[model samples]
Target: MSADRETLEVYNARAGDYAQTMGRDPAAMASLRAFVARLPKGGRVLDLGCGPGSWARAMLEMGFEVEATDASDAMVAEASKVEGLAVRKAVFEDIDDVARFDGIWANFSLLHAPRAAMPDHLARLYRALKPGGVLHVGLKEGTGERRDRLGRFYTYYTVAELTGLLADLDMVTDDLREGADKGLDGEVAGWFTLTARKIVPDTEARTDTA
Candidate 1:
């Protein structure tokens, strides 16, 4: 399934508020820098679920081709205001590219999808990346699915669970970070970031008898 209707409405109505709360942070940009460092200069990157286009704008400034997309009309409108950034209206399920992008930044976005749909969404993302391409995923560190006090739906996951899911899709988990922070909801929560790579053809078919 896609994003929940109430969640979309909340985002539509409070887009500006959310942007204000999520304004660019130097530490966050450091994470982005690390992500881009793994990618070649001028590589094409997809900012899946880009909110307010901050990261997309940063990547554009860093000289990479970026496709910034989100499902919310308000978000797309906000992201389009940035000059030279190609923003589009798209949901996670709308992604259907095959080995097209050198990297995908799915930070804090796919957590909105239902837990049952995560495997398919992850597989689609795997196919969307070039072999050996990098993928960055940020998710709330927890269990099960529920709605926040702000009326937004969330699907949480443990690090091990997500690691297994990525393994099933032949993506190698290489980097991880975890911490707690207060969100727009005024509540401190745990979250984790995972950086993985799509397995290349030879690695996919290799047999390890050791």
Candidate 2:
């Protein structure tokens, strides 16, 4: 799914400030490390909507083959500044490869897409991963879509709503975490991160459902 223009513009203009505001805490660092440990050494990973490439850079430093992507030009530029990082400009819909990545990091990125488009975008992401590949997503917790004070669009989802969506696509939820935090707009919002794995097929029925 394409990113909302105003939201994209906000990120592009504040890429630096955004980067400065984001740094992994002890808990976050542990989560990242846990995710890395789940993957094969040097496995291919896609950092979807990688704003400033912080997570992508961390993964690359850990010796993974990383590809970072964002829809904003400035975000892409910032990501490119990282030595040895391979970043590109593209929307979520641009992910067309099948079973290519061993992991997909879509943290807080897909929230910009319209609620109605979430299923299709997720389906695309699911298709991009190899069987048994891992997917991690972070999203604000709420019931509807709205524009934040910063003029950036957001689509919120309840845990049950999101869990159902993933279940429909045959993704098995593995880990879940929830809390509140201040974002670029200085608002404390509740959010949740879910890590899921694409189930390896045991029969033709599994592949046909997706």
Candidate 3:
């Protein structure tokens, strides 16, 4: 099976437990809160790969118009339970909108995409943003792909590698950090955190054209 499908199956089977286990650290939440604070007031934001919707809820409480999405139906169901949150079912490639969102919180989700498709996916994300929009994505730092003990697939990216992948995109770094994953599952997880702003073009190009 493809990595996306395989990972979806695993997540569907464990969505409830996974949702329950997804608790954010106070420090991380505080940082995210500050990040969102920088956006235009009541901005439209997309919570890409919004597992269980905690961030969506937090963003809603902070007064942003939030759209949350995930590929796993179970995950979508879990996230939809958050009343008033707009939820959808979609994979990474399903994102093809142009100038739609002011911000996108990818969290630890985009790691499921295949390495070969990373650039195209990043470009789609770039096109999906409004002028001067910001983006935040996280990934485990490594080379190539692997399956976790839970049977979920992950495509890792080194800091330099990720930097290279993003270099050609129309964005500038806000923050990129190398660190440990806070060991949520009892093991050290190498991680790379990225925050960036989509550069506003003088004249927008046709990003999606025949």
Ranking by lDDT: 2, 1, 3
**Residue 173 in model 1: lDDT:** 92
41: Cα error in model 2, Å:
1.2
**Which of the predicted structures, 1 or 3, would earn the higher TM-score when compared with the native?**
1
Model 1, range 1-210, lDDT digits (tens) per residue? Answer: 246788888888988987787745444566688899999889999999898888898899999999988988898888898888888888888899999999999988999999999999999999999987999998999998999999889999999999999999878996688887788788888988888998778656564322
Q: The CA-based lDDT of model 2 is what?
A: 0.87
The TM-scores, one per candidate, come to 0.93, 0.93, 0.89
lDDT of each: 0.87, 0.87, 0.80
Candidate 3 residue lDDT tens string, 1-210 = 123777888878888888776764554565477569668999999999998898899899989999988998988999999988999998888898999999988888878888888888889888998988888887888888888876677898887777676678847865665666544345678887777788766565455331
Q: After superposition, how far is residue 104 of candidate 3 from its true place, in Å?
A: 0.6
Residue runs of model 1 more than 4 Å from their true location after superposition: 24-27, 203-210
